[model samples]
Target: MDPFEKMSLVGLRRYQAIVKAQLPIAFSHALEETTPWAEKALERLQKRENLVTEAIIKLEFGDDPDLGSQVSRSAAEE
Candidate 1:
């Protein structure tokens, strides 16, 4: 076994290389083994992002909008 792997400490370059090398392998395996799970995760994330965008749009331009004014006031105070 490599000395770094045997111990808790690794050189910075070695650590970076290890991470860089493993990312593709990990992603490939994840894509192959967890297609449905990955798709569900992505869909959930997209739904969350859409909800956040809608909320932000409402805050910026709705009838009872207050966050924009609050942000501008805070910036002016600063």
Candidate 2:
């Protein structure tokens, strides 16, 4: 992979870690605010894995020209 792809991957990995770490606290706060709403929101949010992944990928890779090209080529090869 190119440098940009590597960098973006690193960023994505870090972002995932941060999100994972914060999720429980976020859910707890949400629950404290309201149980039923929190549960429903969490359910809907959990179902958006693909969208979340794509958004992260796009945010990480879209701005860098090198990463963008690498991603495009990789997708084409697949």
Candidate 3:
């Protein structure tokens, strides 16, 4: 973004042939940088899925079974 902004300031704002040419390369680099972090987050969620589900169930059905059932029914309908 900083490089693109520099290019824009250096050249015409309305038409940036250089920026347009480099957009895909820049986007690819950005995705490459973040992909690992995203993958790790997804892996962590997958690993903890059962524990998270148990926590949610406990919270939902803690004190009121009727309310929990209503919520479950509404969510199912949706």
Give the number of the best model, judged by lDDT. 2
TM-score each candidate. Answer: 0.38, 0.40, 0.26
The C-alpha stretches of model 3 lying farther than 4 A from their native spots are: 1-15, 35-78
Q: On a 0 to 100 scale, what is the lDDT of residue 76 in model 3?
A: 41
* Residues forming the 10-long window of minimal summed lDDT in candidate 3: 1-10
lDDT of 3 by residue, 1-78 (tens): 222223222243323333345545555655677777655654544434333332344454665777766765674465
Which residue pairs clash within candidate 2? none
For model 2, the superposed segments whose C-alpha errors exceed 4 Å read: 1-7, 35-52, 55-78
Model 2's C-alpha root-mean-square deviation from the true structure amounts to: 9.3
Candidate 1, residue 55: lDDT: 42
Return the clash pairs for model 1, or none: none
Tell me which of candidates 2 and 3 scores higher on lDDT.
Answer: 2
TM-score of candidate 1 versus the correct structure, residues matched by position: 0.38
* Ranking of all candidate structures by their lDDT, best first: 2, 1, 3
lDDT of 1 at 74: 63
Could you tell me how far off, in angstroms, the CA of residue 45 lies in candidate 1 after the best superposition?
0.3
